[model samples]
Structures are given as C-alpha cells and as structure tokens.
Target: MNIVACVKQVPDTEAQIKVKPDGSGIEEGGIKWVMNPYDEFGVEEALRLKEKNGGEVTIVCVGPARAMETIRTALAMGADKGIHISDPAFDGADAYTTASALAAAIKGIPHDIVFCGQRAIDDDSAQVGAVLAELLEIPQVTVVTKLEFAGNSVKVIRPIEGAQLLIECPFPCVVTAQKGLNEPRYASLPGIMKAKKKPVDVKDAGALGVSTDRKARVVRFVPPPARAAGKIICADDTPEGKAAELAKLLREEAKVI
Candidate 1:
C-alpha cells in the first residue's frame, strides 16, 4: 500500500507575531516556523500505519522554499520521501485555492490513500481535506480519532456528542486526523542523519500547469480582542456555606443553572 500525508509550515505557537506596517499581514521578520500541530498528528499516524502494515509513506506540502525544513522534519520522523509544491502565487491563497492546487499536484501521482490534519494551527479553517476530497471525487472522513485498515477498505472512528461513530470507506480514501490519535515521536540522532539523505522532490504549482490566479485574497489579519481579567468573589467561610453560595452565585450570575 502507498500512503501520502499532507503537511504544512505554520508559525510557532510560542512566538509572537507582529503585523505589517499597513495591516496587510504578519511581519515576516523574527517569525519562527514549525510544522502545524494537526499535520504532525497526520504524519505520525501515517508513519505508524506504514510501520504496522509495511507500506511507503510520502509527505506532500505546498509552501515557499523555506517549507523544506518542515519536509525534512517529517523525513526524520520516518516518511519515505517528500514532495514540495512551492509557488509564489500560492502564498496568499485560501483553503479553496490550496485544495485546488493540491488536487492538481496529486494528478501527477497515483496514491492509495491520502491523510491530512483536521486544520492548520494558523488558519484553523478545517476544510481543506473535504475540499480536496470533492476535487478528487473520493470519499473522505474528517475528525478521525482512530483508524484501521483491512482488505481494500478502511474503518475510521469519530467522536460525536458523548458518543463515538464508526464508519467504513473503500480504499483510496482521504482522512483528516484529530488530536489524541497517537503520541508523536521526536526524531532520533540516526533518523536526523538519514533525513539529510532522503529524497525530496520540489515543484512549482504554476509550472506544473496549476493556475495561481484565483479567488480568496487575504484582506488583513487582526488579533482577537483581549480576554477579560479574572475576579475572585469570596463566599461563606465554611465549606458547606461556600458550596451553597457558589451554587447560588453560579445560577444567578453565571446563569449555568
């Protein structure tokens, strides 16, 4: 079996991003990049499945040339190889544009299954996998917490309101992974060394006959409004009194009851 995982380069969650002078985008300077958290789970799941069943795991990503760092990280994590689709025009594209471009990119290869994260940390739109599935005309399951492969078919487990649902789809399906699916591993010394020798092929979306002139432009990015500060309201001094006061206050002020 041949499996492909989609990865992305996203801003480090610890880093503080600065806006551009005119409020168009984030300031590129001093911005550190890392693999998207969701994508990491997808990669880990792919590697785990391949390790268990013995298949080739390939990583695919679309970003600037700097994205190779993320690809290399996945390589160290045990993907067999990688494909990088770097195009200047794709930089500001939205989920629609991204999925379309990736669909065109995959047109050049034959894949048995495709895996992606539930969403990118930066954007968190959480729609690319489904859009790609529509473009490819294949079945897709999102927010999957557990997965298993059988003869020419795959089963996925997704969580709903206080319940889990099991669904089955044919082979050559697309899956978007959710967190808690597995514990991700760090690359070892030997794996890092081997990553440097792994094959990574790069392609430009525009050069690959993929159109960049498309819909979805970034108008601007603004930070969310600050959260309100905490307040401590003292209740009765005794434990029982405090519990009663807390329940009363919650029902009245917080409106939970």
Candidate 2:
C-alpha cells in the first residue's frame, strides 16, 4: 500500500495576524508557521495506515519554500518521504490550480490511497481534495471521521447535521479527514533527527506540467472592522424598564431586532 498524504503550511492559530495596509494579504513577518491542524489528522491517519499495512507514506505539499518545514514535520511523525511542489507561478493560485499541481505530482507516483484535510485553516475553502479526486478520476469521501479497511475497499463515516453516513469506496481514492478521525502524535527526538535526513523531491509547476491559470482568485483581503464597545443599560432603574430599553436599542441602534 503506497499512501499519499497531502499537507499544507498555515499560520499558527494563536499567532497575531494583521492584514497588510494595502488590503493584499496578511502580514507574515512575525507569524509562526505550522502544519494545518486538519492536515495533521490526515498525516496521522496515513502513518497509521502505513503501520498496519507495511507500506510507505509519502507526504505531498503545495506551498512556497517555507512549506518544506511542514513536510519535514510530517516526516518526523513517521512519513517515509515527501514531495514539495513549489514555484513562483503558483503564487496566488486558487483551489483549482492548487489541486491541479497536486494531481500532477500524484500521477507520477504510486498512490493506492490519498488523504487530505477537509479544508485548509487559512483559506477554509474545503475544495482542493474534492477537486484533486475529480482530476484523478477516482472516488472521493470528504469530512471523514472514521475509516476501516477491507480487502480492496475502504469504509468511511462522515457526519451530517444530525446523522452520520457510512460510505465505502475502493482503493486509489481520496479522503478528506475530519477532526474526529484520529489524534495526531508528536514527533519524538529521534524521529525529528531522522526527518532531517529524509529525502524531499521539490518540483515546480513547469516540472509538474500543470497550468498556472487560476479559475478563481482573491482580489483583495480586508480586515474585519473593529468591534464597538457594548452599551450599558443602567439608565433605567427598573428591570422592566431596562428590558424595554434593550429592545429599543436592538430595534433602533443595533438594528438587529
């Protein structure tokens, strides 16, 4: 079983993020980068699969040079090798373009199963894995919380609003892992040292033969407006009067009634 796990680099959730004054993107100067949390679940699942089936787990990533750090992070957690897809042409790429590059790399490799996070925490698009599956012409299961392996097929459980759906798909399929899939393991000291020696094949868009055309693009990024201070309703002496004042404020000032 040759398992391919796709990972992405994203800013730490706790990092202080500030938008560029030009409304272009976030300020990356002091941001701490890490592997996307959901993607970590995918990597952990891949490692578990490799452990059970006795095969190699390859980490595939699409990002700039800094993304190699994330790939090595996966390696430290027991992935065998990594493929880093990086290029200037891929800058500002949309989900379609991103998935295209991933599909191109996967096409050249032996992949019996492919795993990806349900969505990248940065963009929250939740489209790359499904798009990659479509480009590969293989079956795909998204938002998967549980997985079970059979002879040549895999069963997955995905949750809906109030119920869960159990789906079965064959090998050579794509699965987007959800949060409940599994707990991610931290890399040991020995594993961290070994990861530094692991081989990572860096490929460009041209090398992958993927087009740079973007089906969608982010024109601009604007920071959310600063929240306003809450108003105190202490003007009214009675509780009923305070409730009436609150309703009036909601209907007039807040306009949320």
Candidate 3:
C-alpha cells in the first residue's frame, strides 16, 4: 500500500490564541501544540491501509523544529517513518508553497496513495492536497468520508451540500480525508517508545529544491473586536410592559426588527 500521509502541527483548539501587537502573527509562547484533528483521520486511514495491504506508511510534515513532535505523534500511531521539512524560508508560507515542499519530498519516496486532511485547522485552506496532486500530475479526491480498495484503483465517497458522490480513482492519487472517515487510535506505551527511535529525514527548502516565492502571503493578523455586554429590561413594571419594552428595544435601539 506504500501510503504517504501529510500532517500538520497546530495550536490546540482549546488554547487561547493571542495576536501579536504588531499584527504579524500569534504569540507562540505558552501555547500548546497538537496534531491537526483532520490529519489524524488521514494518518489512521493510512495505518489501516498498510495493515490490510502489507506495506509501510510514511508521514510528511512542514513546519519548524517543534513540528517533529507532530511527526513523532503519527509515528507513535503506527506510521513507518517520517520526513520533516523545516526551514526559515517556509515561515508564513501560503498553501501553494507548503504543498510544493510536500510534493518535493514525496517525489523522492515511493507513494501509491497520498493522504491529507481536507483542511488544516490553522489555515483552514483546503488547497494543499489538490495543489500537490496537480504538482505531481496525479489525480485527487477531496473530502472523502469512505474509501475502499478495488485492485489497481480505489472507490471513495464525498459528501456535497445535500447529496454524496461516489468516485473511483486510480493509484498514485491524493486523497483529502474528511471527519467521518475513521476514528484515530491512541498511541500505546510500546508504540510511543518505538517512535522515539524511528527514522525521520529532516530536509530544508534547498534540499527539496523548492522556490521560496509565495503565491500569497498573510499581510497581517488582527484580533476580533470584543463583544458588548448584554442589557437587562428590568425597569418594566409588568410582563406585558416588559414585552412591549423588549419589542421597542428590538425595533428602535437594537434595530433588529
């Protein structure tokens, strides 16, 4: 099955994110990082595919040195090895640049199937898998909920607005996993220990021979405005009066009506 799963490290969903005063980026200090939830499904699916077809699963990630933890997390979950792309040039890189780095790394490996999350939690840009597929000149299927092997090809189910589409794609294809795909397994004690010794090939932008030019960049990151406090309508003397007052407030002050 020679599967390749692309993953990312992101701030925990429960973590309180603070934007920098300069609006360049968020404050990394005191922030807890974890593997993207959507990518976990892709890793789980890759592990399952390897267990069934008898091959290895490789994890590919692009981030700073801290991202090695995310690759190790996937390794602890049963991936065979990892490729960590860490370089200063990739800082604040857009989806196209990130996908370019991933494609460069995967180009040197044996991959029959490439798995990625439908969208990264940090960026929420569901473009990497498709971009990588295009760069690799291979087919792609996005937001896949269910997948089944069919000899040299695979069948996948993708949900739309109100309906679903069943697609059959050949080998050497990219698949973006959706939430309903599968449940991710926790790393066991033995797996965790083994992951510490697993091989991880670290590469830089130069090693991958990828250009640093970005298709787009984040100019600034601004925090949302604070919410206003709620108002009470306790001045009304009776229930009917309160109702009338509320209506008046809605229609005049709030102007919602």
**Candidate 1 TM-score versus the reference:** 0.88
lDDT of 1 by residue, 1-257 (tens): 78889999999989787777787888778889999988888899899888988889889898999999999999999998988989888887789888887887776677778889999987778989999888888899889999888778789898989999999989788899999878889998899999999999888875677778757676877766778995555665788887888888889988999
Give the winner by lDDT: 1 or 3: 3
Pick out the ten consecutive residues of candidate 1 with the lowest summed lDDT: 230-239
Q: For model 2, how does the per-residue alpha-carbon lDDT over 1-257 read when each residue is reduced to its tens digit?
A: 99999999999999887889998888999899999999999999999988998899999999999999999999999999999999978887899999999999999999999999999989889999999999999999999999998868899999999999999999999999999999999999999999999999999988988898999978889888878888889756799999999999999988998
Candidate 3, position 193, lDDT: 100
Which 10-residue window in model 3 sums to the lowest lDDT?
228-237
**lDDT, residue 46, model 3:** 95
For all predicted structures, in order, the TM-scores are 0.88, 0.91, 0.91
With candidate 3 superimposed using the best TM-score fit, by how many Å does residue 221's alpha carbon deviate from the native? 0.8
lDDT of each: 0.86, 0.94, 0.94
